[model samples]
Structure formats: C-alpha cells, structure tokens
Target chain A: MTLRAASTAAADRARIRAGEHTGPTSGLAPGLAQANLVILPADESLDFPRFCVRNPKPCPLLEVTDTGSAHPDCVAADADLRTDLPRYRVFRDGRLVDEPTDIAQFWRSDLVAFLLGCSFTFEWALAAAGLPIAHQAQGVNVPMYVTNRRCISAGRFDGPLVVSMRPFAPDVISHVVDISARFPAMHGAPVHIGDPEEIGIDDLAAPDFGDAVVVGADEVPVFWACGVTPQAVAIQARPSLAIFHAPGHMFITDRHHDDFDTGESHDHP
Target chain B: MTLRAASTAAADRARIRAGEHTGPTSGLAPGLAQANLVILPADESLDFPRFCVRNPKPCPLLEVTDTGSAHPDCVAADADLRTDLPRYRVFRDGRLVDEPTDIAQFWRSDLVAFLLGCSFTFEWALAAAGLPIAHQAQGVNVPMYVTNRRCISAGRFDGPLVVSMRPFAPDVISHVVDISARFPAMHGAPVHIGDPEEIGIDDLAAPDFGDAVVVGADEVPVFWACGVTPQAVAIQARPSLAIFHAPGHMFITDRHHDDFDTGESHDHP
Candidate 1:
C-alpha cells in the first residue's frame, strides 16, 4: 500500500488510541506534522511555558492546550491528548515510572499539555530538497548531545541545551540551511555548524542520546536544537509529575507540512 | 546635531526617566528599537503571555519581566520600567485614570511588565529603503482601525484585532514586504493589502485611533497588525488595574535595529 493508504496521521492516531500501534511514529505520517508532547500539572505549568518562550529553538511551541484541557485546538482538531500519541513516558518526581500506550488512568483536570514543534517537519523538508538525513537513511535515531551552553533559566527549569546532529556536504550547507529556515515553527536553522568542540561536544562517536552515525570526511556536522531538551529539562526539574512522548514516538497532528511555510504572512495577532 | 547624537535610545530613556521629556518618542532614537509596554497585576499575568504567543503578529513579545521586577533583562540593562518610558497611561477597572511620566506611586509588588515589539522598527526599514511612510512624511500618527478578525483568546484577554495602515505603490509592495519580513519580532509584513473594507474598516479616512494620512491614487493601502491590539484588549478585559505606554510615547531600549534580524539561529531552549 502507498504511504497515504497505509497510514494517514488520523488513522495512525486512531490505531494508537486503540492500542494497536505502540511503536515509534516516525515514517508513519510522512508529510504531516508530528509534535513533541509535554504534560504538566497546573501548579508547575507557569514556569514551563516561560521555559519554552525563553528557549524557542529547542521548544518551538505549536499549541499550548488550555489549563486542564487535552484538546489542542491550534494544531489538531477533535483530538484527545490523553490517548492519541503512540507511547508516553511518565515521570514522577523526575523518575521514570511508566511507559504506556495510553495515559487515560493518569489524566487529571489540572494537567496542561504543551505541543511543541518537532524536527520531523523539517526532516521532510530536507528530504524533499534532496538532502540526506543520516539517521533516517541508516534507520537509527539522530545523534543527540548535551552542550555546555546553558539554557536561559525559567523558574525551576534550568539545564544545558541538547542538540541533534546531522552531517551534510560543505557545498549543500546553504541549501540545507535555506530549506530548514522556512519552518521556524520546527527548530528553524542550525545552532552550531562544523565545530562540535565549540558547543562542548567532547566526542561525536559517543553521544548522550540516540545512535551516532558516520561523519563523511568532506561533510560538516550541523546541529539543531533538539525537542528533547525540554523533556530532559522537565525531567531534571523533578516536578511532582511530568509526562512526554517517548523519543521518536511523536503525537501526529492534522496539519500538513505545507501549513508551516515561513513565507506565508502571519498577519493576525 | 546628527540624529544619533541628538537622541540615542539610552539617552532618550534617561531623559524620559528624569521627566525631562514627555512627548512622543517618534523621530528620536532613529536607528534603535522602541517597544510598547504593558503592565498587569500578577493575578492576570499568566493569560496575557499566552495571549501574546497565540497572537504573535500583533503582539510580538520582546521581553517579559520577572514578577514584581521593574527590569526587562532580555532587552535592556539598567532600565527602570516605572520611570523609563516617555509617558504611561494608567487604567483602573478598565477606565483611564492617569497619564504620567513616572508610575512609581502606582507600582505594586505583584505587577508584571511586558515589552512588546512595535511596528516602528519595520517603518524605519521602509524609510531606509526609500519607501514613503505617508504619516511620517506628513508628521502625524499612522491611522489605526479595528478589524473583523478576532484574536485568539487567552484567559480573559480577547478582542478584535487592531491594524495600522500605510499606503505603498503596487510595484514596490513586494519590495516593502521583503524588507519588513526580515524582522518578525517587529510587526512583520502586511496582514491585508489593497482592501480596507474587507477587514471591516468602514472608511480609510476615519480611523479608530491616530491621524489618518492621504492614500495616493497609485498607492495600495497595506494594513499591518498593530501593537495597540494587546493594550486595547487588556483594557477591555477590565482587570483591577492595567498600565501601558501612551500611544506614540514608547519605551526605548538598548537594542539596535540590527539585533532583531530574523535570520539568526534562535536555538536557546
């Protein structure tokens, strides 16, 4: 079956909600936007939104669900945050407690859901522009590192930035940059290029998270602020409770890739 | 004296702080950024920030001061919000009670200050590109109107969008758009072009606020989401008390026009 017939975002979400699909959401909804999910209690909600605003590159927020509401009206229609995503990683007091396909039992009226922009949107853009994405090509997770650069502190949320790396040829760097820059809603442009040491990445072969890939001799490593930063930071903050999507297991939305074009005039306030 | 020497943003702010200047900040601090100010009580602070995020084009937030802090660390250093702006308008129970140069007596320990991006930044870009800003040329405030478009509500803050208009030649519309889009932090790009009635403006000559300038026969009236929107919405919400900079009398910042370039990789989170 073709990609569309095999699994549209809505279909994938329906299957996931029914507990039929519990794997990572990558490649399931090819041209649709997938989001990084963060659910926190009302008491801890204020600081986290500020955290997203201060560190926009790592946490480009797509839609912040109303306090205690699971419906993300801005990015998705008629979707339930509690049961929509494929898998969830629940943390209590910053310790991983559960890995569940659905969080219905844990849902509370005080919970606030933050749907952050994921790199998958830009990854599609890169692939369309004919740029190689090493991790996807190799069928492995993108290499992520903990940089020495500290994120601007908001309330109790404070940590170093986490970045994902992809190696690209020197000549195509501009093309890659141009294509990715169009989706500021996604991580936007590369944070660091060429020098891993400058951002405190001690070694490329050993990554903090995900599998490291081969860096071609003529290729330069481009690092973009990863969505993992907020999840990691939220975990570090050790709030009473925090819930997020499993790495690579994103929450798919109704929005298409073209909906995020930066060229479109954002005239409404 | 030259424009730079005659009035630097820092110097203009200092003069305003000492009550030496009380007039509109226009034509002063030519190349620096000026910001619209909003001060709300801590009880109402949470919803306002979310409102800004939901309606970014009209309410591009520059800096959100820490609760009860008069300093906006992101945009200015050594600046006091209570006394820095040329003038401030105070509203109590949604009614304008006072317009003062200094708000020290009105300051509360629970107050939160927000500095929003202003369209003046883009207007300067247009002027530098030799595009005529009719209102500026005629020495009057740009015409502003209420539009049919309703802003996404966040808590109690909800109202129709307010837009400012500028007439540009049809041939240079693309050029004007190109220059303005570079500063998304400022009100970037026009929301509507060539049609005022479509957006609910009954007549271009009769504006809701500010002075209306002549639209040339060959010119197309372009409307941009105005910074006045948030303030108007905030006032309509009728909190216990709200404070904001008077129209045209803005709070000057230390940042130069170039610091807000949209091309930079914003990967802070």
Candidate 2:
C-alpha cells in the first residue's frame, strides 16, 4: 500500500504499525482524523454497519475496509489495519482476552474493519472555533454515561446509547450547538441538553466511564453521542471474535478533519 | 406502525396506497421530502446498502427497512412500501419486466427495502430559498447523463456514476452551491460544475435519461449526482429480483426538506 497524501497521520500510523509506538494516539497527527476501530468477521458483521447507519449520532461511520482487506483505501491510502493502531483489544465471545501492540497474527481473511467518526474531530473543531471544553480544561477524561435511549437495533448489535459530557457556560451553549452541528459525522450536536434525568442519567459527579468534572456556576451540561458505542454493543452481542482499539488509542488516517463535513464530496465512507 | 407526525405528505401517501393515484409524485407533497425506493431480498442484497454508504453522493440513504418488513417506520411510519409508491418497476435478471402500480404481488417474505434521499429535497430547498430552477421553469425533466466516474463497488452492485444537470447564471452559482450543500442527503452539491465533457458528458441537449431544457446565455451548467444510480447498477449487476420506483414516481415521506440538513436530530433514519 502507498500513501497518496502526506501528513503527520501517515507518520503516526507507520510508527504504530512498526510496534515502535504503543501508547494513546491522542496527541499525534494534530489536524488529521483518528478513527474508532472495530474489526469483525465478514460472515457475522452485516448488521453492525447497518446499526451505524441507523444510529449515526453515536456511531458515525468514517470508512469500512473491504472484506478481508486490511487497507481502507478511501480514508488512508497506505494504512494497514492489522497493525496500524497503537494498541489493540481482542474480544472473544464478548470477553476481553488480550491487549496487543499489533494484530498481524490475529488477522484473518474473513475480517472486515469498520472505522467510526471519533469526538476528537468535533473537539478539534470546537477548539478551533474558540470553544472551551470542560474536561480538557479540568485535565480529566470526558465523563460518559449510558442513557435510557436504546438504539434502534439491527440484528444482535443493540444497547443503551452512551454519551460524553462537556459543560459550557449558558452564554456559549448556542455557539457550541451551531459549531458541533457543522460536523454530523463527528457525533454532530448534543443529543440531550439541560436535565440529565430526561435521558435517564442520575448523577453528574458519578459517570459510567471516564472521569468526572466540575460544573461551574450557571453552566449547562451538554452530552454528545460517544464513540464507545460499538465496544459497548460488542460486549452485549458477544461476537465470536472482535478487534478494537484500546481506549484513547485510535487509527490515525491521512484524512483531515474538514473531510467529514457531511458535504457529499468529502465524507466518502 | 403509526405515524407520529402528520402532514400533506401523509395524505399523499394515503392516496397512492389506495391505487387511486398512478402518476408521478413530484408535485404531490410540495414541502415534504420524496425518496427514491429500491427493494431487494434480504439474503442477496447485503452489499447494496454498503454500496450506498460508499457512494453516498448519488445514494444518500434515508431509511433502510428491517428485514422482510415493508413498513419504513422511520420515514413513513404507517406507509407500506409494497403499495405506497405511485408506480413500481420490477426488474428480473437485469431487464425491465413489469411496471406495476403496486408490488404486493411481488413482495416476498425476505424482502428488504431501501429509501434514498432524492433531489426533490434540494429542489424544495432551492424553491423555498427563492432560487429559480432551469428545468422547472422550462417545464421539463431535469437532464441526466452517465458520467465517467465509477462508484466504489460492493458485492454485486457496481456501475458508472449518473448526474443530473441544472444550469444557473454565473452570479447565482455560488448561492446555488451553498444552498444544495446544506442537504447532503439530497445528492448534495454539484459533482461537476463547469464542463460537461470534463466529467464525460458530450452534448448538453442530449441526455441519457430525462428531458433536457434550454440553457440560457451566460448560464453555466451544474450537475449533481442523480438518484437513478442504484437503478442503473441493479440493471448491470442483474440481481434475480429488484424493484424500484418508476422514474418521477417517488415515495413521499413525512420527512420535511429541512429535516435532511446534516443536523443530527432532523435526519434520523
């Protein structure tokens, strides 16, 4: 495989593929997109992509690799899925089995890889738009909660929708909505704003996953569809074999953030 | 299944479902969205949805019905796909076999339906925005041509891209671009703006499908991906049984034009 576009993303993927970098990909490839990876057997994974389409907010699809092909030609020209991500999590019948730096040994001819839009794209857009992210400012992982809204199921992949919270003062919430709405592939706008109980969230300090943050005076908590959905669904559906990127360790692609604007020409996954 | 929302679109669907309306659905539901319909069996049509996701420009998906279900609960809650469309064209082994008003006779136990975003949404937006459409003013079908662009192939569906032309004067082309870009699900933005032959179109007056209108002096031709792509591919791929909405006779849904704006909440299918 060869990369037609040169960017820091290609360099990062090369390092991860070589087993030289085995850490989180959060800080790498500053302007490019980092995808949430889910690789499943071709024979059993038909409904997963369908699930993504039905629930686009929580599971925005970026690129789906051809069956048995490790290369996702549309998103990254030279990238290889088998060893591209910094870290990997192997799920066997919905149980976590191993965390490997590379999955060349686990690669199968019947595997199909799915790359989903990550919040990092929206966070990048927010930061660029001068919107302050609460979790980032507090130096804590964004808080995630499992909401009561059940996803419209497709086959066996079904679960409660998970959301990541970011608090913004009431003054700037409108701008946040407008800016985030500009990137639908990146979870788009908040699924719920204001009351947590409206969507079945009971606590602000205690979250289902990640760290809690301080909600300042008169600040409204905003929740967006989280990229952790596929992982949650995999644990429930219990697929025979599923491979995913470990938390915060993503597949950096040659595609830039702007390419996911929902304009037909750009988001071609 | 019941409709949660009611509009003129629902009334129009009721008329068509009763077999009282056997004409094109263009002017039926003025403000609501109309969809291009394609139905295939569940067992053999796995790759068709994948093809739509990959080639979203021409095939932006609105709602994909559950396996063996004719009710598109998302787009039209109570409408039945087997009878709601004004007309249906049945293709057998890649050749047009019948054009029936209703496909209840052809419906099978494992059939799956796909509803795609049509140019009607964008045209509705354009008209609402007060932009003049060339073909509509001339009272002709929008001219369409087979382009050299090859859509990303999936399983048994593969074919060349088809685009519909809309001529706009130089001064208003930018506004037209901005307006159409808002509705990505509706074949968003012109795939080719300036030259016809540049994208493989030879003559402006001669189109592969649909009627051509006269292009005024100084008005440049803009071409957007047409919804006929899936039909063309079905013809080439030759699925054992494929059904589509007869040209100009679409499935009017309860979804409004603004609902398709890339805003996460509005367009949920």
Candidate 3:
C-alpha cells in the first residue's frame, strides 16, 4: 500500500469509513486537524469533561458531542463519531477488549463522545516551520512516556501525565516553541524542554509507548503533554465501559490545523 | 473615604470582608487579578462549566470551587468565596432578589462557585502600556452592549454575546491589542475593532449595560467579550438560585495580573 496525502478531509474520512484506509492517520489529509476520540457512558460524562477542563494541557477538548449523538458539530459538519476514525479500542471494566475498525455495532444511546485536540496539528506547524520530526524521519511512532507529574483528579479520572517526545537542535528550540504556542487547541508547547530524567524518563531509547528515535549530541528531548493521558486515566479509573481511538489512529476533522491559530478568532479554544 | 490602593490583595480582601471597603474593587490591589463570581446549585453545575469552556472569550474561567466549598484554591490561597467580595447580587429563578455584602446565609452544600477572569487584568495591562481608559478617565462605567452574536449553547445556558467597549486612539490600537492578546485567561484581545454596527450595536450613547463612555472622533471603539456575559446568561437561563458579584465589585485573587501571562505554566488557565 502506498501512503499519500489526501486533498480533502471529507474524502479522506470517506475512505476510512469505507474501509479503504485502515492504517495510521499520521500524515493523511495533511492540513486537517486530527483528534483523539474518547467515548464514555452518560453516567461518566459530567466528570470527564471536568477532568479535561482541569488538565487542559494533556486533554485539550475540541468538541464534545451530545449524549447518544454521533455528530461533533463544532469541529466537523455532519461527521459521524462512531465510524469516522480509522480504528478504535474498546475497554470493558478498564481492560482492553478489542481493536475494531468500526464501533457502530457497540454504539449505545447512553454514550457520550469527546473529541480532544491532538499534537499532530502543531507537528504540522513545526514541520512547516522547518523543525524536523524525529519519529517521522526515523519511520516509527513518536516516543511516549509516563511522567511523574499527576493530573488533577476529577471524579473517577486520575493518573500520571503522559508525554510525547521529539528531539530538536538546541538553537531552534525557541523557534519551535513559538510556532507550536500559537495553537493552544493542539497541545500548545513543550511541557519539558531539556532533561529526560527530571520528568522521570529513565532512557530515551526505551519509551513506555511508541518507537524510540536517536537524540543527537547537541539536541534536547522536547516533551509535549500527550492526548494519551486522558485515555490512560480513563483506563485506570476502571469505568464499566469506555472507547477510544487506537494510538496514532485519529479522527480527521474538517478544520485545517492552521484554523486553530491564536488571535484568528475569539472562540477557537 | 479615600480610595487608595490597598497595600496587598490579602489586605484589600480583609477590608472588604470587614465592611471597611465598599467601593468598586478596580485598582484596589494594584497588579492583582480580579475575578467575576458566579454561584449555582449542583444540579446546574455540569452545564455551567461547559458554557464557560464553549465561550472562553467572554467567560474565561479562572477557578471553579469544589462542590459546596467557598474556597477558590487555585487563584487565591485560603480565601473565602462567600464573604470576600464587597457586594453580591442574589437571584431567585432569574429575578434579582437582594444585594448583600456577604452570602453566608444563602450558602448551601449543593452549590458550586466559579471564579471567571475579568477585563480588569487586561485593563491593568493596557494602563501599564500607557493606553488611556475612557470610562476611568471620565469617572463612569465602561460601556457594554448585547451584540447580535449568540454564544454557542452549552446545556441550558444560552444567550447573546455581551461586549464591553473601550475607545482607543487609532494609532495605539495595535499596541493595545498586542498587550491584551497575551492574557487569554482574561478575555484576550478585542472581539471587534471599529464599527459597532457590524456586531449589531445601534446607538453608541445607549448601552444595554454599564455607563456609556465617549467615543472620540479620532478614536476607534474597541470591543472585548465581557465577563458579565455568564451572569447575563445565567439570569436568562433562570437557574433555581444564583449569586454573582455586583457590577464592578469583583473578587480579588492573590495571583498578580501579570502572573497570568501566556505560556508560563500549563495549569494556569
């Protein structure tokens, strides 16, 4: 199978819905905003949104669908939440049940879906600004680790923060920060810049999740709050039922990544 | 009778608690952040926070208290929410019931309090940058209007967007914008720049709320999403019981105004 950038978000999602695109959505629909999807029962809906609000860096909420509704009206027009994503992970009582291409069979009227902003939007910005993405260059997944920092607990959601890492030359870190900071809807800027041990990462080559990449002698490991934090928290909380997009496979929204640029509008975030 | 700047936030709040201070909290504790307060029952708790998240420009939430608690631990350390402000307005089923200095008698275990960032933080930034405040200079309230723009509805809280007007010299508008844009927690930047008619303001002399300030011939009227928006929406929604700080009698937080400068820490917002 050949990997190519789809020209339109609608077309890309159509392919995913039709089962023609089942691989990771990392580079598909290049300029479109990709989101992490989390579906929970209505019983847990109130606390979950509050959790996202309390820990915004790791869980920047884009749009939360009304209970039992599959449409995320804020980010996309007439998009179905249950079938838009490439793949999904279903958890029963906090344990991974299965990874499936479509969740329409498991859809329940009591479920609420939350669309969270992903770092891919800012990665597009960083790459456009000439910053190299280590994982993409190495043809592997971005390194992720469980940080020592704990997210503020909301109801049943509580866990350590998770971060994704990218190595950048020391001289260009400031430029990298500026470009990424403009999109707070996406994980805004690097949470930790220089040292890995300070954030409780024992080694860069051994990421808790994703593939490891080489860190140059003069490069610093930059970490951004990952959308995985919320998923991890949801798992640890042991809710009776929960659903999330499989890692690296995201829901593509109609909004372009640059549409989230700060100061463009008052309500972007 | 002299409205001198209190030496510190703690001192200012103490004076307000003791009834020694009854004037508007503007400039009372220079450099400190002032907040707009809203207290609602737990039954309406879930939707109110969602409303703030949806319309961040008009209702940039600073801190939301634990259910039934009167303390805002994030913004001010050990500050009592019930009696710390100079005045409060009580509403019963959306109608004004009473104006009280302390809401101790009305406090209930099922109530939740939200502290929203106020324009005073950015107004301080504007003054520090040497931009004149028209209302303060003229000894009147800042002009505010209910625009035709409707805030995205969250649960039952739905209403038109309310904006505060500040006239700035055409040449200095950019400087004003640059400074205010840095404080996203405090209604960052102007929503509209010049023509009020564009956002549906008919008469400049008459505003839906607040006193009208003069719009100099060479000055452009800059409008920012007002903090009063949530209060207006709450009133319109008509929750069973609601409490809010009286107009201009804001709650002062220990954090300095500039402490909310963007990109400082992930948890600030």
Candidate 4:
C-alpha cells in the first residue's frame, strides 16, 4: 500500500481503517494530532482517569471515548475507534496476546478508550523553530524508562512514572523545554535534565521501555513524561483485558498537529 | 473548632485530619495545593478515567489513589483520602444521600479516590497578578453551570460539561487567559470567553451547579473547566457508589496553590 503525504487526519484514518496504510503515521498529516491509544475494561476506568489527572506531564489527555464508544468524537469526528490506528496491542491479564492492525474483532461495549497526547505534537513546535529531533533523524524509536519515582496511583492503576529520554546539547535543552512546554497537550516539558541517577536511570543505553539512543558527550539527557505510563501501570495492575496502540503505531486524529501547540495563540496575540 | 493558618500543608492537613477544622478550606495554607475530591467504586474506575481524559477542561486530575488505599503518594504524602477533605457528599445510584465531614465510616476496600485540580490554583495566579476575583471579594462560592454541550463519556460518566464562571473586564480576559494557561495542572485556561450560548449556555443567572454571581455589562463572562465535572458526570452515569467534596469543601495538599504555576520557570529564563 502506498502512503500518502499531506493527507488530512480524517482521510488518513479512513485509509488506515480500510487497511490501505499499514505504515507508521509519522509526517503523514503534518498538522493533524496523533494519539496514543489505551483501551481497558470499564471496571478500571475511574482509577485510570485519576491516574492521568495526577500524571498530566506524561499523559496529557486528548479525548476519552464514552464507555464502549470506539469513536473519539471530540478530537476526530465520526472516526472508528477500533481500526483507525495503524496497529494495536492486546494485553490479557498483564500479558501481550496479540499485535493486530485492527481491534474490531475484540471490541467490547464494556471497554473504555483513552486517547492521550503524544510527543508528535511538540515535534511541531521544535520543527517550527528549526530544531531537529535526533530520533526522527536516525529513524529509530525514542528511548523510554521506568523511573524510580512512583506515580500517584488510583485504584487498580499504580506504578512508577515512565519518562521518554531525548539527548540534546546544553543550549538546546532550554529550547526543547520551552518548545515542548508550549504543547502541554503533548507530554509538556522535561521531568529531568542533565542527571540520570537522580531519577534512578543508571544506564542511558539500557532503557526499560523503548530502544536507547546514543547521547553525545556534550549533549544532556532530557526526559519528558512518556505515554507508555498507562500501559506500564495498567499491566502492573493486571486488568483482565487491556488494549493499546502497538509501539510506534498511533491513532491519527482529525486535528492538525499545529492545533496542539498551546503557545501558538500567544504568538498570534 | 478554631481556624488556623499553618505554614505547611502537611500541618494544615494534620489539623483537619484530627477533627480540629470543619469549615471551608479556602485560604488556610497559602502555598499548599487544594483539590476537589471524587470517590467511586472499583467497577466504575475505568470509565471515569476515560471521562476525565476526554473532558480535561472540566476535570484536571491531580491524584488517583489505589483501591482501598486512602493515601495518594503524590498529592498529600500520607493524608487519608476519605477524611482529609473538610466534607464529602455521598451519592447512591445517582441521588445524593448524605453530606458528612468524614467518610472513614463509609470507606470500602473497593473504593478509589480521585483528586482533581481546583480553580483555587488559577485564582491564586490571578490575584498574584493583581486581577480582581469578585467572588473572593464577596466571600461566596464561585458561579458554575451545566452547559448544553455534552462531555465525552466514559462508561457511565457522561453529562454536560460543568464550567465555573468568572467575570473579567474585556481588557483583563487576555491576561486571565495567559496567566491561567500557565497552570494546566489547574484546568489551564478559559474554555469559553465572551459568549456563553456558543457553548450552549443560555442564561448566566441560572447555574446548574454553584451559586450565581453578578456579571457587569462591562465584563465578559469567562468560563473555566470546573472540578464539578466529575461529580455531575458520575451522577449521570449513576454508579452504585460515589462520593465527592461537598461543593466548596476541598482536600488540602502539601503543595501550595502557587506551585501549580508552570509559567514562572518559562518567564524567568
């Protein structure tokens, strides 16, 4: 299947829903919002909401669907929840059972879908300022870690705060923080910078989550809240049923990614 | 009971936890964070989390406690969730049943506690910037409303978005937006400014939630997402068990109200 550029998020979602685009959605719709998807049984819904609320740094919420409502009406009008994402993960009793492009076969009315803000939003801010994201340049996954600090738990959702690490020169760290901070809809700002041990990550090369990236000697390791949190915490809680986007396969939204920039309005004013 | 102004939120929480203070906790600990509390059974936890993630404007999550765990490690640092708040409301099957000072007697092992961001944090920001908050001057409850617009539902947690209204002169609305935008931890910025009907609110005099205040002709009716959202949505969902802060009563946290400001760091550099 051929991937198209400048496709509106809605158009891209339709193509993905139709199984025409099985590739990663990076740069597909430059301005559209892309989301991290987490689906869980209704029983754990309340605690999850509390968890996201307490940990907004990593899981800045975009849209939460009605119980069993696969459509995220607020962000993507009339979009199908089960199949719009390029790929998905099925976790049963804390273990991965399947990696499929569509979750329609396992759809449940009792399942709740949470569309969380992803770092893709902030990448727009960085690019707007002409800063290059290293991972994107290398065509590899961004590094992530399970921090020593525990996240505020809610009911069946409790675990350590997870952070995504990005290496940048000292001059760029402040710029990165400023750029990312403007996109609070995405994980906003760095949780830790310069020191890895302070947050209990001893080896930058070995991450608990995503693949690690090389940090230049002059570059400082800057960390932001990671979307992997809900998955990590939820799995630890061992819900009977859970579904999420497969790593690197996100749900693309109708919103232009630029709309995710909270600071754009400031600039206009 | 005597009112005390303690220097630390922990100290204030200790006093409240010991049954020494039973009144509103509006201005007790100047720097400590105060939250809107919502409690529900484990069964509804999943849906509620989705609800909060979807309707972030009305439900800025602060902390979510584990099942049967009254203590949220992030917000209060050992404070009991069931009793730290000045008061609570018990809703059974959607109907409010009781308003009590402490919920320890009613605590269940399956219950989950959620602490949501309150407007108090943003109000502190406005006051710090010399913006006038009329309700603070009148010593009354902030005006809130149930709008015609529906919130994104998660399971049973579906209802109209409830917003707290504040009137600001046209000149100050932009500053209010800018200042409040910095505190995304506290509902961030105004969801709607100027026209209420655009969001489905018809009359300003009639509020679906809190008391109505005067809005002068020279002022624009600015609305921020209210913490009342969880309660209103939960009631609509009609969970078998639900508890929340009784309107104005709130949970005092160790973090101060001003600590929510995400702008100072950005402004300093």
Candidate 1 residue B207 Cα shift, in angstroms, is 0.8
TM-score of the second chain, cand. 2: 0.95
Q: What TM-score, to 2 decimals, does candidate 4 have?
A: 0.85
How well is each residue in B20-106 modelled by candidate 1, as lDDT tens digits? 998998877777888999999988777887788778789887777777889876667678999998889999989999998899999
Report clashes for each candidate as comma-separated counts: 1, 0, 0, 26
lDDT of 4 at B119: 87
DockQ of every candidate: 0.26, 0.36, 0.25, 0.32
DockQ-sorted candidate list, best first = 2, 4, 1, 3
Q: For candidate 3, write residues B193-243 as lDDT tens digits.
A: 888899999998999988988888898889999998999999988999999
Comparison by lDDT, 2 against 4, better one: 2
TM-score of chain A of 4: 0.93
lDDT of 1: 0.85
Residue B143 of model 1, lDDT score: 98
Q: Give Cα distance to truth, residue A81, candidate 1, Å.
A: 1.0
Q: Per-residue error at A108 for model 1, in Å?
A: 1.0
DockQ of 2: 0.36
Worst 10 residues of 1 chain A by lDDT: A260-269
The superposed Cα distance between candidate 2 and the true structure at residue A185, in angstroms, equals 1.4
Better of 2 and 4 by TM-score: 2
Candidate 4 overall lDDT versus native: 0.79
Second chain only: TM-score per model?
Answer: 0.94, 0.95, 0.94, 0.93
Off by over 4 Å in 2: A1-5, A262-269, B1-7, B263-269
Instruction: Report the first chain's TM-score for all candidates.
Output: 0.94, 0.93, 0.94, 0.93
Ranking by TM-score: 2, 1, 3, 4
Error of 3 at B22 (Å): 3.1
